[model samples]
Target: MKDQIRSLQRLLAALSSRERAALLAARPAVLQQPRPRTLHQLAARLLGTASLSRSALNLGEQQFLEAAVAAADHARGPGLPFVCGRRDLEQLLGVGRGVTADRFAEVLRSLTALTLAWPDGDRVWLHPDATVLFPTALGRSAHGRPPLPAAAPLVVAAPTPEFRPATGDGHGSGAAALHFLDKVLGAFTEPWPALKQGGLSVRDVRRLARILHCPEQESRLWLHLAVTLDLVTERHGRWICTERVPGWLRTPPADRLAYLAVALADVQILPGLPTQDPKLLNQSFATTGPSTHYNAATLRLSANYSAATLRRTVLDVLAELPAGQAADDGPALAAAVHYRAPHLFGPYDPTKPPVPPRPDPYGHWPKPNVAEVTAAVLRETELLALTDRGTLTDLGRAFRRDPGDHAALRAAAEAALPLQEKATILADHTVLVPGTPSPALAELLRDACDLEFRDVRTETHRITPGSVRAYFDQRPGTDPQQLLDALSTRSTTPLPQTVTYLVRDTAARHGHITVAKAGTVLDVRDPVLATELVHHRDLAHLMLRQAGPTVLLSPLQQGPVLEALRAAGYAPNSELKPSAARAADRSEAMYELPQLLLPPPRRRRGPGVAAPGEWLADLSVDEHEPVGELARFIYNRAPSLGANDCNVLATALGAGTTVHVEYRTPARTHASVTVRGPRLDHADRLTSAAGRTPLPLSLSGLQLVLAVPDGRGRPVRGK
Candidate 1:
């Protein structure tokens, strides 16, 4: 970088007189020439300077420019259309949602003004020459070093992330993530499906959150991750957690967290809102703190973020707090947020404001809802038990600093109930189990079967169903007497009369109407559709025949058959033979979140931070001694084919050497061009390799000229 800067400065000074005059006239105070006229003249001229000039762009813009150029150059032939939206830009920059959309637009404008970019339809496209203009990773420099990797996917954690030692009872968060997964397991396997349109409605979420004692948004985040990872699927407009859940259950708890970490890392969805009421939450913070709901949501998901910065911010706060205690989790997370993304938060002073009657020093600041950002990320950590009371949890430390530590994770995984286990049947209607039963057991018990409340945590699980119909079925091998006999075998004690009678009554009614399906038609007996079929208007249109009062025949398929009967006001329930594969992978299509989460681009690889000749370009000389040192430095740094013009110009002209020539374009805007093979006319105009001949330029327009060295040391004169 240092060498490149030096080369650029000398190049600027040694431009042809015409280019020099144009450069002086094109200084900040001068009006820039309109495009297509001064475009060519300034194109290459600006290219050299923009490389060394950081003034036109912020760090984010610089990164975007390099990424766009590299991706464009490699993926497509240069100049093909590429995407540059909030998503691509934000991830490329490590920016979270905290960075506003408007700020991104400002960066785009800067690149365009430099002619490095231009608006192409809705998205901006790079100039065709951008790859050459500022080759950060592609083109090699004339000087032997390779170009610096553009925004080498900046490593987070300033210097590096600090890891605190872990301490716990060796019991990890008791498979908190899996425990949540277990409850989800129960919901998916439950007989009465609660999902709406394949997604758990807010109500379903709230209910599940209540049952699990987990926050609504946290549950949703995990569920979203589950869906994203293909562990769960959607079918019949309802979510069917995939076979992976059972696979997940079978794995040790530590492994579950490991898998979850990968899935969580891939989540692009922001944890929506906290469980707390928004209006109430807003008031709790001072005067709503200038953060709108939209801003709050965006900050968590899309704000530019730096991992190192977040770690530093969090550690700094922890340093101030008492050991293992956090003043507030939200602020701790928020501290890291703005610390990592100051641009996203703007100039807002996050410190508490002085009470009224005093001027508001922080009034004009762009106060984002840092609290929401804090809360959202905090919940994410909570899933892995990464935070205990807002401070980083020992497990979290393991996740961040010591990924190798699997002991704690292993302990957590050991704590979840085993999948298959022996059962206990009791005289009362309830059944008992050992360990936390898997969803498979729960599904077998589900006839609106719910986990019942009990005083003892480790006691057998009691399956509580409202009626006996939940257990009895008229399936081929099932009989009330057989069910009673089975219960007796599982229990050492006699079955209760209530239990006996319940199974008997339910089984007696189960198959009263034996339904048989042959092709599309359903044959029913036991007074099937019975006399009602003969009297029904809708059934009259179908191929219906009465086979005695107890039997009716209909040609309609099962689904349409049920619908037609129901439409005619007959109350009927549709039941099909149970499928061996419930919510099988084939039964449902895997749906992805609307947006795909892309991992952050990997860090720059390979070597060569300095482009070719970049060392000479960036090398600086002491300007105070311009008389001697300046001349020597310029001469030494000058390309072997080109002579430095600071000390010698008109007297040392040669072929293939560059000169800064000033000229007036048709637009009359002052423009500068660096031309080679000096050609001058008495009219004071010059043209060279660029072939932009005969443009108007005065003798005075020739401000500086470079002399190229011919092997014979002979200087070329204008013909």
Candidate 2:
């Protein structure tokens, strides 16, 4: 084992800085840990138990590593390294007729490049740490060989008879979803108590679910979506509606759907706070299932791709089906998606049930499998009216083509969705909307009547006494007559007598049984005394009033009111309920849309590195002559500026380009550092890596500056 470790160390030491960067880039979990200061530490990190399990690998790469581990286990104890020939690896991988030589070779190259396995002579040396990723679960074939590659499942088209062409615009689901979302947002217009961990408590979640008339699980998702879309935010340990609510409320249904579709596409994980960093958002959620919390290990493993990428991929695959047709199943669709972008998707087994995620210290909920994620994406499409009856719609196609094009999304939606200005008013207090009503009419109906049923083509609202009373209670000054006028203006036919009578009668009883607040109440044995206290001159500031012949009420606190009454020549006994502490008010910044137009989903940029062959060739260059990409960058002199020049460096930083910076050290020696993903901090120092080491380099010390080649080895043109 010690010999194997030493061999690995030597191999790592031989790797150039460029090579090391490329290899470590694939193991983000390793980079996330404390930086390794030496080759041995780097090697140890590469083979660490935690890093091995968390590293993202495609199915092919995973299979290759498993085969290597199995071969090592077969040849010797698990701790010893085993050299396996190319032929043996091919056999162990079950790479038979279906697998091509080039494809197999590419897999090996990727494994070697990633340092999961490395070439030694004509064979490959397997890292014993592979056993951590793939234990003894190497099922063998009948001939006692590893099983064949788990081929991507084929996507079969649904039977033609199963295809159901939507007859009307498929905007019903989205419209209904938007209505429910508005309700959820409206609930937050007032501050709501939150737990210390910055999440809604169980009782609060249940209450919110009840208010939204949605199931608890689904309601939580909607609540999270409100935060994700920035329509609501947390402030002072309380949830409150953002200023964006007003504009969002006024947006047309189609426009609102377009905004929501884009927002949902950008959501990489469920039940997470909204963040500006797209990568952090991508890393937070393991599965789109109902899980409210994810541990660090699962989060690290799931960071290979963003949810936006997955959403686009799923929509693109679904678009391939003939109009009106859908895929057979989610697993098949997920397989096709993986086949298209294997690098983006980690190892996913559709045939197996999802591995249950370890209970998060914060919370526990069900985790999703690959198939479930695909299904969840499809469900989101359905919710946005992007797809109808499980098939892609015109709007869906438009969104799939370009989710960022808000105008195009809204245009497609408008063309498909039907909108009505007037609704049908029937007898027996029933209001029927044959099509989606205008926003104004819909709001009036929702506020004035009780919704009984709603679907794609129609909605049923009944004007009930209780619903009217509740609406009137919520709107302090709005009377039944005002509501009636608004309803009459939006209705196609005259209001029925039953509806009119119900509204008027409900309004009449709204404040009949009044409830009023009182700080102190006094009981007087004599009715005359109670009446006199109500009109007492000394206690006039208390604004005392008579509730009954024997009862006297005051708006002030019990202490002050009682003292005033006693000083006014009467002794009053007191009984009071315990008062709760009031929260201290603090001003918070109001949440607003970043811009009128939806911000495009942020695309995470990877730090640039030279291609493999180029980096290897640079290793053989002469000492004095230019070596490595950085040296070549300086040699070519694409463009050069004074070390203190902030113009070029600023441009490069904004563009997320790598910069080759030559700076003077305090020792008066000149040195160069390749700044990857450079950013100027508030202290005016550039923060990024100088080779594999991250350090803050002062901008004033720079002697010369030039931009480096992008990851693919193409030089970035400079000004």
- TM-score leader: 2
- How do the residues 530-634 of candidate 2 rate in per-residue lDDT, one tens digit apiece? 777777788788887888889877766666665566788886665643231111111221223476777899976765544543543333211233334433433
Which ranges in model 1 have alpha carbons more than 4 Å from their true place? 1-4, 7-171, 191-198, 275-300, 303-333, 346-368, 401-719
Spell out the clash pairs found in candidate 2: none
Cα lDDT tens digits for candidate 1, 597-676: 79999975433344313422342332322235534444443321122243433332333454444443444234566555
The RMSD of every model to the true structure, in order and in angstroms, is 20.3, 17.0
- After superposing candidate 2 on the true structure, give the runs of residues whose Cα lies further than 4 Å from its correct spot: 1-171, 271-306, 309-313, 320-324, 337-352, 359-368, 425-432, 438-719
TM-score of each: 0.35, 0.43
Error of 2 at 1 (Å): 31
Worst 10 residues of 1 by lDDT: 283-292
- Top of the candidates by lDDT: 2
